[model samples]
Target: MMFNKLFSFFTVFLIGSSICFAQNANRLDSLVTVLENNKLPKNEKIQLLIKIAHNHTNTDEGMHYAKQSLQMAIEINDLVLQSQAWEEIGTIEQRLGNKNNALDAIFKALHIYDSLNLKDKQAASYMQIGGHHVGEKEYDPAIIYFQKAEKIYSEIEDDLYLAFVLTNLGEAYRFEGQLENATTSLTKALELNKSLKNDVVEGYALGNLGMVYAAESKFTKAKTFLTKAIAITNRLQGAYPTCVYIAALGSVYEKEGDFLLSESKYTEAFAMAKSAGLKEQIRDFSAVLTGFYEKHSDYKKALKFQKVYQQYQDSLVNRENIQKNEQLKADYEVSKRESEISILNITNANQKRWGIALISGFVILLFLAYLLYRGNREIKKSNQVLSDQKELISKREQEKALLLQELNHRVKNNLQMVSSLLNLQSRELTGHPAREAILSGKYRVEALSLVHRKLYQEGVDTKIPLKDYIQELVLGLFEGYNAEFEPNFSIADINIGIDVAIPLALIINEMVINSLKYAYDGIENPLLKIVIMQETKEDLHLQVIDNGIGFTKNDNEKNNSFGLKLITSLIEQLEGTMERINTKGTHWEMKIKLS
Candidate 1:
């Protein structure tokens, strides 16, 4: 088992080769060169300097250099550089165990990048913030930041970065026992890697996929992918990320009841982490490896890893407490340095009086300055709140508009269905009278439908046009019927408002249906004419005449047919007077004054 976990120099070589192509520089020289280049694009130089600062170990000198770079970035008003600098500062602060400062700095950087729309920098900033949140076990916010970064990565079509972000997101999901989403995200990460041909990311994706599979007790497939990842890392010469790959693979081997293989891998990872100066990783690696050896009944090796884990844990606690003590001492020393002064007896009394007066003056000036500063801050906060609320209101309004459009869609569908049903009924009936009656009913529905349709077609926001309605009503009477059997339909001036046009259009449809069905059967040169005229601005007059059959008094009341009864009712709905004559063919006219 111990031998099975041994390092693959091939993996280490492969990983080392990939990073070797990156720009090389001495840390101090790189920082100085970037800082001295006053003409360089602000973002590029700052990013290069930050990369150098991040590679430095935790030390006062290293932190001082990192801070100097940040100050330069901020002084130039370079938002991109400012964001990158803060990220480096966060990395340094976190290494020094000032987690609060680290988190705050990274968050501030994230805010700056977000406002500037510097997406790649924003993603990096979010990833840093996520790292801190993960360290605190605040998984919810960690997941949020990771997802936001993933979205930006997707937008930029950076599949490699997207895969990495998804891996972390999957990790958070798995930690929360959301296995389904974890599997989905991790699987997508694998697909992305396949597209980019990035073997390193491919390995990571395989390892995470293995994690999900192992958790579900699919040992066989888990072993295959983890082993593939291990082999790939061997080709890379086992670079830093491979440390995580190995640690994860070891867990899969352990789950598969391969105790010896798991122990050997864990031991190799622990050694590599320490060699790489990843102390915290070594601690985490050893603790996990210890569990494997203990399960295998190797008490000595198990005890060794356990003892080392405890040693590291105790050392971290001691370091934190020591930092706290040092902070207190530093505070005391600063206070002491500030106040010590020398004076003689007579001079001391006068100095004390003068000091008191000076202090009072300074206090008043400070109070005034503080009030002005506070007032500005309050105003800024109020404006920000207002801006946020306005954005929320706009979002709600957009949602409301979408919902209203949907309603219009449904309404149009319903009315069209009603018209279709009436047409079908008209087609199935036999007698000329019955056919005319049903067809006429369908036309009335069509007219009503036209108004609803206009509402939909014009984006569901405008009123209907009376003149346009009459024109459509006249045209529809002749369409989709046999041309030889079609009527010579003509229109005159019409000024009917919506309320008048709606029912009046319905009546015309019925009268046209009647002429086409019975009056023009087996007859040549059939003509149906509709003329509408508004004698005054507030009044409309309409007439429908046909050179076909004439009407009787009984036909005027529709006493013999159901179709005529419906037409009479529709005419009443329009608040119009009706007249009919079949003499000299057929002549029909209606008049109405619309409000």
Candidate 2:
């Protein structure tokens, strides 16, 4: 199933490549014959050259004609024509597998189009650039460029080209595993092509939609769409894309558990691809068959197809290598010619400059010696000033650190005094409802006091190690409640600043108090677990679980409880969420966003 999905992705590029070079040979010949007329006007000749180049894509002849058209357009100062010529050159180079050169030429065309405000041509250039990105399997940039082209084509009401961009855009979405988006774009493309009566692009749109369905595992719909696509391509005699659709149908069959039918379809598609001389399709289908046979435990057939796949893979690599060698040779020739011209120019100029060169050299030496002496003197003065400034900055930083430490120590002492006063007040109101509230307030104050104490002792003013603080906080709660066992702790190593630490500490205090008071009633062995970890760079996950009597309906509905309200307020202040579960015990899960 995975192989089939990958096969669908690989064949989209093959389909695109085939469409590019599938022009009628007779039409190309007619264009060449017309080009033979020497009396043709320059502008008409330039247009003819571009047309011929488009028909000859993926061939050196196409590049030659494109360059010729570009030169003529430059001579006539026609920016639109020049841009069109560059677009053709880019498309041909891309089809010939020269990506960098392709992008360079396409951007050149885009620059010219932008300067001229040629919306239609600019959109076309964007589509070409998008197609290049798709060929490289870079779907993000491909989708971006395709959307740019889609917008312009829609604005211009160019339904034909709009369909083309939409089709490619849908294929890119499918490649990126965005099946719903792929369906949307392909369906729109299918409608546009139908309205425009463009059978070729219509077939492509249908084929891509089928692949999207196949990826989603909707085998019935997959077969339906792929069968329709096959019909269209078959009627149009599109052998390459037809074979691709057939292979996609085979994948659908494989996923549906129709092994015999799947094998037949795979073999049929392979035979058709081989007959059509589609090397990429042949290589891909060979691989698919290799996998299919291996799964069926047919080692003999698997080995045979594996060797065939390797052969075609090697052939494609060799073809790319040959193209690179030819490019290198052309570059070397150009460089050699440039070097010969530079040598000639240098030789002619050197014959008349010997006496002046000696005079300039002597003057330069004296100027260099004087500048070096001045540079040394300035360097010494700058170094002395830099040293003094550095020392002053260091002294100021130390003073600031000492001031922060003193402030934290004072704050901790003041918080401890407040807690002591709350404790005294709580003792005075014995058996009174207000005593509970005072004690809760005292605990909250202690939570904040711990944070400051940690800062003062650690001598770090800003952030505190939260795991150590949480351990101490939880241990203190257990001791305050006189619990029989310590709660399990699974805390990650995280440091947080005071802004987050204060509110987070208060939240934990409220939650632990509620669990100790309400949970663990009549339980033989109470269990408590506290988990704190960073779930992402900007989020922290905390879980406080206890195994005791679960919360009753009344407990769950206590929205007005002071402790519950306090917990909610602190969580809100921290920009966090809380979830409570009551099964065997109480479970408190919270995710806080870190600033």
Output the number of the TM-score-best candidate.
2
For each candidate in turn, the TM-score is 0.43, 0.48
Alpha-carbon shift of residue 107 in model 2 (angstroms): 3.0
Candidate lDDT scores, in order, read: 0.64, 0.78
lDDT per residue, candidate 2, 52-84, as tens digits?
A: 887652357878998999999999998878877
Q: Give the alpha carbon lDDT tens digit for every residue of 234-300 in model 1.
A: 5644434567667767776776678778777777878777775554566677777665665565556
Please list the Cα RMSD from the true structure of every candidate, rounded to 1 decimal place. 25.3, 20.3
Q: What's the distance in Å from true for residue 326, model 1?
A: 20
Query: In model 1, which runs have C-alpha deviations exceeding 4 angstroms?
Result: 1-45, 51-68, 71-77, 89-102, 114-120, 152-160, 231-240, 296-300, 315-595
The 10-residue segment of model 1 with minimum total lDDT is 8-17
The weakest ten consecutive residues by lDDT in model 2 span 9-18
